[model samples]
Target: MGCATLTPVPEAWRSVPQAARITDLCARVSCASRGATDVKVTDGKLVASGKDLTPQFRAIQSFDVSLERREVAFAAKRSDNFDIGLVSLDGSDIHWVPEDPADETDVQWAPRGNKISFVVHSRTGDLVRTVHIPTSFQLTADFPYTAVRALGWEPAAERYAVVLTSPEASERIERLKYSGEGRESVVAPAVRLDVAIEPLADALLMRPSTLHYGERLPLIVWITETPFEWNDARGALMRNARVACAIVRQPSEAFWTAARAVAWIDLEKVYVVSGAPAPSPAYPGAPLSATSVVADPKIPTGRYRVDDRIVRAPPAIVESVAAGWIAEQLKDRNGPR
Candidate 1:
């Protein structure tokens, strides 16, 4: 039996219903483009064709679709200006987020699609930042933050992982839980988030948990020239060795590590990135970055992959494709899709 029949796999997986719904949506969109609009009742709107109306967005550098929210959050850049936005699946209006994305910022949707976080460029430097999807409250780290490598969370969970490199170049993974708003009798309500980062790897490759559910966060690895020594979060900072095999090694070599799917290769069947061309490998040496990546890989273990070839896509194009996928996967189901 599938842990989730509608879903399974890393940044990638083989979802039958997902494809069927997407195909049907595409057909409807094709008809709409030809001026034959046929509307269907879905949890969310599906915009297969037309414009999302964010003309200023030059390219969608990082993006993800939230099937639960029926929306897509993305970071797009034009010249030196970068903006973040939340767009519905119906190709309607684009709602601008208040986040001031640094060149390094990549919009991330929470596993539950309730929260969003990213790195922000401040006058001092870069900082780890977060914003709730509903309330739109923002949180910024006080310290001198450098970059956000990856973020992960357990399915339907409040606890999340934030991997980062300090300005001094030290790498750490912060285990965090959303603490909601803080209110005082005198002051207005403010957002509060609890975080504790343990110095885990000098270089850790994070295959973050997906917006859709899986058993748990995927098996992350410390990069090296040889086969990966899995870095399960059980050995995370302050954790008192739940598993005896939790060996800790300092990161010496920095190889680019990313995941097409969040689960380990053995756990989920690898699925190819559908509706994508052959990977161009164009984003070479851009730095190890991962935010909200959605993929379905149907390949074997030890062959993890992601569709970075599409990273160079214009913001509208990426948003369009991702928005469509989110809308199609928005069916009411028992399993994560």
Candidate 2:
């Protein structure tokens, strides 16, 4: 007897089949850069300047930057619960760059471009990873702990700078290098700068204000929450509410200020920090003051606003591929009827 006649598979059955495979969907989608990486930081206080900061950025988030004025890279959140994105643009609009399967957060684009580094919040603290653009490849940057004070890269030096936190101890900045096939990371070990911002570390967050890669060795400016010390019996338990900025050069160069935000007015002869309270730092003659024409954006920013619940358009081939897969599966199930 011949096999029974095969009718169109019901929607339920169609849901399970395989369609034509899409080797690479990234090649199909295209968009221009809207300077997703154009984050402006001037010498000023690190306080919010009433800019209706995005909710996602209210907490810990990545700083945005264009590899240059022409190239920009950023991370847009795809879901409310997890951050799963890294995208780029060349002055037009942003195109999605792929992410590692592991859940990642605290994303930052490398100053050199075509690469981004992020932390994977895992059971064992935070694991750092670097995503290579256009290829969607991931390189693990092994960090000992999950708490990151600041993260940035100086491609010219062939190293990355990271500020790590030790809640029970001091906070330090360390440089790392990547080697091996997967670019496994190795810490410089001895190269580190240790600074303490106790109460601030507890109440607020930390992130690289920006890292300057220019003719001289790269310098990193990091924004830390209000500066706090031991609150010795001689003074109040907490310092007045204000932001702290740290400018560091690998060989133990660190500067501090009680500015509301910072703007790189000159960065060499004179650095600016605005909204100063009688030239703060409270050290009588500390070098923090409201001195600059540029206003700091408070928090680093990107060109586009990311919708927490991204209503994104999936790849066009996705449906076709799924449909094709389902049809093939249906064909196999029903045989040659």
Candidate 3:
């Protein structure tokens, strides 16, 4: 037999393909030294004045520069989550900001470098955390909205604006006033209720591994009657499939109504897997028409009649079955992956 060379398949064609990119340098170019030096993070390195200053080992998510001190405040992945760090303009000296278990992003320097602020993503809710550099004092103000990023700080560092993203992926600016001891409240730019109130504050959202920018994908909303927790099977569903999942607890009519407005969701492929009986007619004239329903066998089928189409499976294989069904539905629609 003649010797032949084997060509490796492209990542897109592989079943277990890696993501195209996972860099944290999402922010734009930041200015330092009173606009004398232009600094930014790219390819895991800090570039200042067209020169790479920081080491390439650390993965930076978002960053800001202090004009007074000539230091860069950046958020980088520490372990499972992200942490804030400080680096000199020369990249020779590095300091650690106060670490938190939750992921911290959008690091911003105060006007005089006396304080720093970032948003912390906690399981229960989102918090805007501020730390004083001199006293090392930490102050946190809880917010009901999901903070996308820190916009800017006030001159006194007691107030700031953050971009809040609703469940439907719409963003709006909200200003918050901060005090050292009390819980800060929204100061200006009230929440817009023109469309629908922001829900999904308690929902646990999971995205597919190989998600692309500005790409719409199928969604599976698991409406849990009780508390939800992460397990191996649920993790596998997200890792192996090319669909977005949301675990919604105590889902209200507004949730279903707002979900229809999400620009990135393929409304035709939105499926609901409920642990309780089918929801009532309180959902604003039946806005969301779920593609399919995957009910828990333990719960009596209220609206749906159990037939041969409904396959009863064990708890271990439920996620697998759900993934397969979603794939089949996507195939039927001839949707793009």
Candidate 4:
């Protein structure tokens, strides 16, 4: 019998959420404008009434038109990151939507135009935040998967349909109903969180099997594209000391969610070791560049480099280097061991 090979199809033919979302937005824009005038990006400019609505230097990423044809919501690159920009049809009152400092994309206006929704790309995962235009009140919607390409809001219900990719590169459309909950911070003592996260991916949260009464420990969140057996690393670290380690498999949405959810971890001593380089201006602290990142005034940030040597070496050596780095981070201060 001859062996047969099966080749996978290209991603372009598999998923096109961005194009589909843009098409839907364009249709809405066509219907809302009513042919009185036109609103669209022409010559790389947001043009309407024969004028450019956005700054000449900034690049437009995505945009949507209001139902009344009065305002345009668009995402543009200001400096290193993207911010949602709003401007009137007449090219007046150009401003940005008040939101967190991250790359916001896929701007969409709610059915009533009173609210705007966009995806915030962070080091942890992709978050869909809807902000009230009047009050600037923000509500967050978290998903179990990353790589959200498109998001749509329902008119009558507080629900969002998100198009995302699974770990196996298959496209999925999930409908989530948000009640302004699910993202609240936990304040209790550190213990196993019995969070009933439906469809939890292969993300694992590891800690010392036992902790002394009222004792907190430092946490190392290792984000990697490839998954490795953590038994050796966990055994080495546990034997050295009581440092908690979490492994976030690639394309999983539980990066900071799993780390921050552990209330017992010493927030000040939390370190991030990325198998790949940290993205630019994505995390709370400085970009993961050197051995450690300076704090971001609000949160601590650091990066650990896993060079070629570490990658080729065994898991024990890789994690041993991490342990040394963490100890160096806390050496100056009398912090958690």
TM-score: model 2 vs. ground truth: 0.34
Best by lDDT: 3
lDDT of 3 by residue, 179-247 (tens): 524323333222221212223545555554444688887776765532223233333344445666776
- Please provide TM-scores, in order, for all candidate models, with all chains considered together: 0.36, 0.34, 0.47, 0.46
- Model 4 residue runs over 4 Å out of place are 1-37, 166-170, 178-337
Give the better candidate number (1 or 4) by lDDT: 4
lDDT at 207, model 2 = 24
lDDT of 2 by residue, 1-337 (tens): 1122222323432222221222322222221222332243222111123321222332334445544533333334445434534322322333554544545666666655566677766433356677676687876766432355455565452456555543222334455653212332223222222323222211322222333453221111222222221111101101111122232111012133322123432233222212222122332322332122111222122111112211111132222222222233223355454
Model 1 lDDT tens row, 1-337: 1122232222211211110111122222111111133222122222334433345445566666666676767766756756677777566577778735345466667665577766665533355566887888876653342344555544555554444433122334444454423211221112211222222233323232232243332222222221122111212311211111101132222222323322332212211112223333422332233212222234233222234322111221322223333233333467554
Count the clashes in each prediction.
Answer: 20, 31, 0, 1
Which of the predicted structures, 1 or 3, would earn the higher TM-score when compared with the native? 3
Question: Could you report the Cα RMSD, in angstroms, for every candidate shown?
Answer: 19.2, 30.4, 16.0, 14.9
Better of 1 and 3 by lDDT: 3
- Model 2 off-target regions past 4 Å? 1-60, 67-71, 84-103, 155-157, 179-337
**Please, what is the whole-model Cα lDDT of each candidate in the order they appear?**
0.37, 0.34, 0.55, 0.53
| RMSD of model 1 against the true structure | 19.2
| Better model by TM-score: candidate 1 vs candidate 2 | 1
- The model with the greater lDDT, 2 or 4, is 4
